[model samples]
Target: MFTGLSAFPLIPTDENGIDEQAFVGLVARLAAAGVASIGALGSTGGYAYLSREQRALTAREAVAAAGTTPVIVGIGALRTRQVLDHAADAHEAGAAAVLLAPMSYQPLTDDEVFGLYRTVTAETTIPLVVYDNPGTTHVTFSDELHGRIAALPNIGSIKIPGVAAAAAPARIAALRAVIPAHVTIGVSGDWLAAGGLLGGADAWYSVLGGLFPEAALAITRATQASDSTAAREASNRLEPLWALFQRYGSLRVMSAAAETLGLVHSPNLPLPLLGLDPAGRSELEATLLRLGLGA
Candidate 1:
């Protein structure tokens, strides 16, 4: 489940809360596209902003909608107990696995982060993916810390942040040496996925794949077939989208894309988080049309 394209879809929401119909449609689309797994409630899914009830409902809906494709539900929360509760909810929802990011308001120590994983692994029955997204979580996992956590029960895959293309091979090698053989290394950051895969990363936990599975699969399959040129070319084709992600952040840009593509209605993001500005939206729409992704 962890060793291929895992699409992390946005969980569309409005003032009334989760838009189940739109969210289910998104999951079903990924399933039909034959993505190896569907990641629900990940950072792209706006998990951190949702309440427990909303997240649980999203998990259930995603699992139900995904059919045979695996569903990996994110169970990250500020508190350990809350995370455990979310994990249990994911288990009850029939998630194939759970993704855990060490979320923190206060800056966390290496030991504290390790302890968080220890506690969650001790309690949860579902296999957990270590989500190392420092950009949002504010908690970084050193390779040594990852080794420690990977040794814990239920640690199935480690989702690492993006590294430069040149450094990808060595970066993946270093992680491979520390972590156990059974624990797969999944790359986040869509732009880095091709390099990471070519460098020996096992899977792609991709935000872009969630919205455009065929496009992401093009890169993933090309890399899997050992066609580096094709993979790089595929990734290069999306350079404009990656730039937009860098400029406005993936969540905001993707929300706008979803609206532009008519997958969801406007004001799709949770309150306190806004979509892309007019100029950014215009630029994104133009880029999308150039790439043949505009609605």
Candidate 2:
């Protein structure tokens, strides 16, 4: 809640449906490992792939498992009414917040994005966080647009991908100046988080933290304590994992890692986005060992 690590874990699923026990167990593990919050239905969580029933059940189990640790449900969709429906289910499931990313097959204008948030926030009393993942959604959020959304009644946080390594600190600083102090700035893309944290960003919207919450917490705590050397060291130790993320995608790598580590079984990922190939398997498993995840 106070500018810490928020995990977006791989949404564990089986052939039948959302693996309730496996999903809840992962949430409990992250909470035990000191994650400030857990998010379900994120890009990594495969939100768009799930049916409305699957999404509702996933949110319910996640919130129940998280207990005191807050759960943020991704309500991102191609349409306003559909996103509103997810928000209603998430709030009813006891989620602490909803993450909104305006994704569509057709390109969207700035005004349309703002209107989507405005309508969803007005409909749900639960706090909403702006999820700006341009890489996947192709819906970029300009600084002016971020400021406008920050003024929305229930909007509370913005999850942004970090800028280039050299310019990250400056970008975070500039964003801080534009958005109100109460609105939190969270950095996603695991590779970009260290610079953002060093630059005073409030939270890390982490993917690997989905598996290694304590390790992510270590990096954040060191930065907050003003120990840049230790923070960088901690972040550097996980560089091997980031390499895999860049090459074959975080969702693929995370699913493979989770299965190899026995955290969960091989998942039934939506088609055209299956597990890693043979070469990726060898590389990813080796990195997991290097990171001492006992793969």
Candidate 3:
């Protein structure tokens, strides 16, 4: 009955890349802190920049760190085989589920999008989480497409980004209204936990869970208990941290936030990302301090 949940931010590495042991340790900490799941190599985790090998290695380490908890592997790519390969890797790595978004290279027609999800679903036996984040991937799967995908047996769930949180309840209810009860609808916004829960999402894929699982878990539990007051209180307390996602775009800020929280070695990002500048760093630090999460 995980009607609400949180996931660790998959922070990327500098030049040499993420330390396997350190990454595993981060997941272990998240698991200990009560996170229901872990997401590695995501936008927050810099999935796009990771080499295929790095992605697989990160998945393996994440699954190992999760131990008993579920690991949701991000499998968005330009090619279907690549996504299938990631899903296969997740299965091999002992992941509980796989999350995927549409390919970013080309715009897909509704029929094409449905076909892609159907094809991917056919390849994997594990539970799948369809990702809908128009911000990063540039396109979103329509509700019709989502319903079509949700109808499949192995299509376990869908994780809509936070921007959709306000509209999620009715939208999800509409989707669920057509599909069976087995498929779940989840949200990926760190600040939208309460709204997502209230809106009827089954779980939350949190970016903050990696650095502050305690706060994320507390808020989720409060929402699940139907304590709107407490949920709002926790969400308010977390506003400063969630604002960090807005300060610098998602990926770079996530790394910077990880650095501010001392979850990672440095704020160094991959080429083209080049980490954050001084102003960005100061904003990140201010957000951290305001949230009482000292840098």
Q: Candidate 3: which pairs clash?
A: 10-45
> In candidate 2, which residue pairs clash?
none
Measured with C-alpha atoms, the lDDT of residue 70 in candidate 1 is 93
For candidate 3, lDDT tens digit of each residue in 1-295?
Answer: 2245757565557777766665776788888876777777677777877878888888888887777877888888888888888888878887777888886677777787787789988988887788888877777676777778788768877777674546867866877776668877777767776787767777877777776787788878887788878877988887766676666665667677667666677645777676678888898788777777674
- lDDT by residue (tens digit), candidate 2, 1-295: 6378999888876556777777788889998887889988998889998899999999998998888999999998888889989999999999999999989899999999999988887888988889998989999999999998898898889999866657878888888878888999999888878878887788988898888788888898898898888988998998888889999999999899888888778754666578999899999888878788754
Can you give the TM-score per candidate against the true fold? 0.99, 0.97, 0.92
lDDT of 1 by residue, 1-295 (tens): 9898999999988778988899999999999999999999999999998999999999999999999999999999999999999999999999999999999999999999999999999998889999999988888888999999999998999999987778999999999999889999999888889999999999999999999999999999999999999999999999999999998999898899999999898889989899998999999999999999885
In model 2, the Cα lDDT at residue 235 comes to 85
Maximum-lDDT candidate: 1
Q: Give the local distance difference test score of model 1.
A: 0.94
Off by over 4 Å in 2: none
Q: In model 3, what lDDT does residue 268 have?
A: 52
